[model samples]
Target chain A: MELLLFNIFNGFIIGIFYALMALGLSMILGLNGIINFSHGGFLALGAYMAYSLAPAIGFWGALIVSPFLAGFVGLIVERVLIRPLYGRDPLFSLLLTFGLAMIMQDLIRTFWGATGLPFEVPNALTHPLSQVYFFITGYRVFLVALALLATASLFALLKFTRVGIRIRAGNADLEMVSALGINIYRLRAVNFSLGIFMAGLAGVLAAGRLGLTPTMGASLIMPSFVAIIVGGVGSLVGSLLGGIIIGVAAGITTTYYPAASDVVIYLIMAVVLIVRPRGLMGQEGLLE
Target chain B: MKSAASRHVDAAKPADAMSSQKSTRRRVAASALVWALLLTAPYWLPLTGGYTDLGSRVLVFSLAALGLNLLLGFTGGLSFGHAAYFGLGAYGTGLMLKFVTHSTPLALLAGVALGGLGATLFGPVTVRRRGIYFAMITIAIGQMFYFVAVRWNSLTGGEDGLTGFERTNIHFGHAILNLHNSTIFYYFTLFFFAIGCAVVWSVLRSPLGHTFVAIRENQKRLRFLGVSVGFYLWIAFAISGFIAALAGALYALLNNFTSPEDLNWVLSGDFVIICVLGGMRTFWGPLVGSVIYVVVQDYLSSITVNWMSFIGAIFVLAVLFFPWGLLGFFQRRIQK
Candidate 1:
């Protein structure tokens, strides 16, 4: 029972990571109409930046700042490389980002080397809370709490902020929003950075748990894509729910047959595609 | 008794006929030039400081990209997961030679069947989605195969990849064809490549091919016209999948090794880039794209460790400047 509980908790944490990732990806897919393949690259960039900044600013300071740094870089990239490709076939943007991902990964490898770097977790968060549940480390609990906090803050911002409302409106109908005289270009740029910010934060947290490697984010990107597909496009909450469902399912499968864990999530996606083709919350014909 | 419309057409017919005849001549000359160069590559390549194996590698990639172009360029489906079928073909051939049989022909057939069947079975699910969703679903689907290859250690040889498979020499009664020779292997690959080109060419000429183009041109219009767009897309997917598998089978034979990388999304991206880089809309675009890509990759990886950066830059530059590709650009210029 303890083992099962441990796996479930672990899965939940992993699911949260996927949800954070899917949320960022979903935002871009919803508003920008481009699948940011380099989101993974941005993720590793965030973690690496955090790693480099930690000694200068301390762990707490670096964690808060690095994601913002990654976001700033994303804003520039969006302005230069991604902005022109808008209103074109999605293929061009997809290929362009795919190339950008390669460049980012290669640059990361060039600077940091290919070896994995261990992130320094704070001592206060390393210890287990109790003897009964030895698996429940303070770091793990902190990760879950912080993820929840971030997600809640995002929801609140979207609900209350002026920019947030505009982003939402843009997602539903871009032409109408533009016709209303809103600067959709500037809105897209902001939304793109916002999505990258989520990836950066996920990276910082993921590095603490999984360690920093140039290729680490590559594997995670696919599952997040599956999460979006299963959750249904154009739905943020659905993405969150989908991520947890697959993560927990994989976690449970890991107990009996470890080899089958990876394939099981794909099975769920296949099932979802068959039963609900439009996804869980996808609006009809909302290609935007 | 001739109508006024017929008389008008008759007056303009001579000029139109001359232009059409000239175009036909130009096309035939271009085809002859390409064939002549390909046929003489073995002799000329050595003179240009190249190896026979490089020629085979180019053909393999060309075949893969060509197959992908059928769906991506002609059928207008952005399938980002095609590497799954390509990898499946390599795995199928490698497994057959490793455990099932020793004959190269049978192994090739088995590999093609395995990869092609996987695509056919999965086509329904993939074809159900269009545009971005289609691209996302395909990538997810490829990852499934990639994980299976990684985890099935006992059968697939795990991350180390499947090995111990050798391409056996064939027997033709009294005369023996030496498969171990690089030149012979190049010819073997070229033979298959020719078959692939012929298949694609003939298909493009057929009514089904026209329908595929129609679907790409206007899906909603075709739907309103009572055509099953999904069904036609599925057919394109399966055929392209078959061609990708054939390329993979040839690739396995070229190296005598197969790995999880064969089925990776990175390679899928490469295939798509090859199509785009060469000119997706052009019939010979895949071939032209594969040549530039494979050669540049070979040359770059030899000199610099930062070869991927250069390759990535190629992808960016290609998309930004020449979205139509080299062939497409030239074709446009000539027309103007």
Candidate 2:
């Protein structure tokens, strides 16, 4: 029972990071009709940025600055590479994003070398929260709370703000939104940058918990994809739910069946695809 | 007899004479040139010493790319799990050669059969979805197989892979073809490549191939036309898998080893690159793409370790400037 609670707690903690990553990907896909395969690279960049800047600004300031930097990079990528391919075949975007990912990965490797970078947990969060029935790490609890706060704030902004309404309108019908004299292209640019910023935020948070490495993005990227798939593409709530489910399942499987843990998420995806091809909360015509 | 033949010829002349004779002549000359190049390449290539092996590797990659072209280029389904089938073939041949008496024919057969079996089982489920969903499901399945290969230590030798296998005899009945000769192996690969290309060419010209084209153009419209889109997709998927496995088995025989990297997503991506680089819609695109890719990889890696960055840049450039691929661009130029 103690082990179960521990796994659940750990799962929720990891799940929040997954949610942040998937939320970015979902928004990009929903608004731009592109999968943004390079989103993982942004995550890696954010982690490295935080790793380099954390010592000077401290963890809190690094978190604020790293995502903004990532968002700036994303805006440049959108303007230069992705914007032209908006009306062309979707595969072009996938290919371009994949190329961008390769470039980012190599850039990280050139700068950071091939070794994983060590990151110290903040002094306050390093202390244990409790040691009673089940031991809980203070840092993990803090991560979970921070993730929740960020998500809630984003959700509230999207639900209530005029800018959020414009973003939503643009996502639904780019042509119609443009017909209404809205700067649809500029809106897409903002959406893409915002999405990348979320990915950067997730990356920095993840670096604090898991350490930073150039190849770390590869590991997280697939899981984020799986989370989005399971949660239903284009739905933020679905991404959160899917991430938590996969995170817990992965944690439990690692504890129980070590050999299958690496593939458990994939197995779950296959089963889900066989049963519900559109995912749990995915709407029809999303892929089309 | 001469007068009757002349009358028949004269009757057929109107339609034949109206067609562009120059285009026909150009096609015939080009085909002859290609055949001559292929026939003489093995002999001419070995004169350079180190190039023989590279040439052979290109041939193997070409065969694999040809298989991928059928699914991606012709059928419009982008699969990210082709390496699973390729690995299945390689491992099948490796394990058989390790355990049993080394017979190349048997190893090849076993590889194709196992690969076909895998495709037959999984193709239906994978072909049910389209676009990103299809790509995701295939990736999941591929990863699942990768996990099995890693965990099943008894059969797969875990992460170490099936290694140290010796090249055996190319036995036909009681006749043993020597396996040690590089020239002989080159000929063997050429023979298989020629047959594979022929099969692909025939399929492209058949009614079923037209159905595949229709399916790619619009699945809904094809479905409305009463064609079982799923059934056609399954056929393409299975055939492509079988061909990939055949190439994998040949690779094992050529190298005398197999590794887990054979089934990695990178290998799958390589196949996709080959298809796109050559021209996905053309019959010979994958073959051209594979040849160029393998050669560039070999030459560039020898020059510098940062070849991946170069390859990535090339991929981006290809998407941006030459989306129709090399073949498509050349064909359009020729038309002009």
Candidate 3:
């Protein structure tokens, strides 16, 4: 019973991280048809930034600053690389993004060697939380709480705010929104940057939980993709649900029948594709 | 009546000229060049020292890229998980040699069969979707295979991979073709490569190939024309898988070992790069792309460990500047 509880706890903890990662990718895909393969690279950058800066500026400061730095880089990429390929063939965008992904990965490898870097969890969140039924790590619980809070705030802003309305409108029909005197190009850039920022933030959180590594991005990329696919593409709620499902499934697989853990997520994706081609929460014709 | 007949003749001229003049001769010459190179490479390449190995590697990758071109270029399907077929081929051959007799023919047959079966099963699910969804599904399946290959240690030898496999003797009825000699192995690979290229050429010239092109141009219109789009796509996927497996078997024979790296997504991406860089529309585009990719990768990797970054930069430039690929670029210049 205790073991199951611990697994569930660990699952939710990791699921929140997955949700954070998938949210960014979902936004990018929703706004632009391009699957930004370099989102993982941004996540890696955020993780590395936190790793390097945490020593000097402290962990809290690094967490606050890393995402913006990553976002700034994302802004440059959008303007210089991605903007030109907007109306072109989709394959070109895929190829360009893949190239960018490779570059980011190589750059990280060059700066930080192939080995994993250690990241100490902040002391304030590391305390143990003992309850009547179970005991949980404070840091992990804090991570889940923080993620939920952030997601709620973002959801509220998107649901209520004017800028959020514009972003949603831009996603639905770019030409129509632009015709209404909105700068859709600027909107896309902002949305892309914000997505990157979220990815960067997730990276920092992940580094605290999983440690930082150059090749870590590669592992994250596929799972996040699986999450997005299973959850439904371009839906925030779908991403949240899909992320949790994959995370929990992966966590469970890791505990029992460990050999199948790596593949379990992909197996889930394949099953999902076979059963629900549009994904669990994805709308029809979205992929089209 | 005379004017209309003359108009008809005039209309047929460009189509005839386009097909008969450039495509036919160019294709023949390219095949002949490939054959000549394959025949003479073992002898001629040794003069440069270590060029034989490089030549063989180029041939292997080119053959694999050719398979990819059939699906990506001709069929207009972006398969992000082709490495699954490639790895299936490699592992199939490797496992066969490990347990059964190290007979090249048997191993090749087994690899091709396994690869075909895997593709037949997985293709339906993936081919149901179009564009990015198809690509994503393929990627998911490919990653699944990779994970299985890594975790299933008892069967695949885990992370270290299924190594220690010896080169097999190629059996032809009563006679055995010895692959212990590098020159002999090159000839064997050359034979298969020629056969593979011929098969691809035949397929491309078939009615199915035209249908594939039509489907790529506009699937909805084709569907309206009473064509089963899904069936054609499934066939393309299966054939491509078969060819990739054939390439994998050949690759296993060339290297005498197999590893998880054979099925990596990066390798699949490499094939995509080869197809696009070579000129997807052209028959010999994948061949040219594979040669250039192998040469650049080999040359650059020897010079610096940061070759990936350089390759990345090259990809960016290629996608931006040479959108039609090198062959298209050359064709444009010639046209001018």
True contacts kept of 1: 0.63
Runs off by more than 4 Å, candidate 2? A132-135, B1-29, B46-50, B173-175
Order the candidates by DockQ, highest first — what do you get? 1, 3, 2
Which regions of candidate 1 are displaced past 4 Å?
B1-18
lDDT of 3 by residue, B110-164 (tens): 9889887898889998888887777877888888888889889998998888987
TM-score of chain B of 1: 0.94
- lDDT per residue, candidate 2, B1-336, as tens digits? 112112212111224443457655765786677667767777787675446666667778888888877987777777877888888888888888888757778888888788768977899888987776677667667767877888878888888888868777666789877877777787787788888788887887799887876677677888898989989999999988988888888888888878887887668777888888988777768877887799888878889767778887877888889877887677666654
Q: Which stretches of candidate 3 lie over 4 Å from their true place?
A: A131-135, B1-23, B47-50, B171-175
State in Å the error of residue A280, model 1. 2.2
Clash list (residue pairs), candidate 1: none
On TM-score, who's better, 2 or 3?
3
* Predicted complex 1: CAPRI docking category: acceptable
- Cα error, candidate 1, residue B68 (Å): 0.5
Model 2: per-residue Cα lDDT over A85-109, one tens digit each? 7766665676778777877888899
Per-model TM values vs. the true structure:
0.96, 0.92, 0.94
* Model 1: residue A17 alpha-carbon error in angstroms: 1.4
What interface root-mean-square deviation (Å) does model 3 yield?
8.5
Expressed between 0 and 1, the share of native interface contacts present in candidate 3 is 0.50
DockQ of each: 0.46, 0.37, 0.44
Worst 10 residues of 1 chain B by lDDT: B1-10
Q: Per-residue error at A225 for model 2, in Å?
A: 1.8
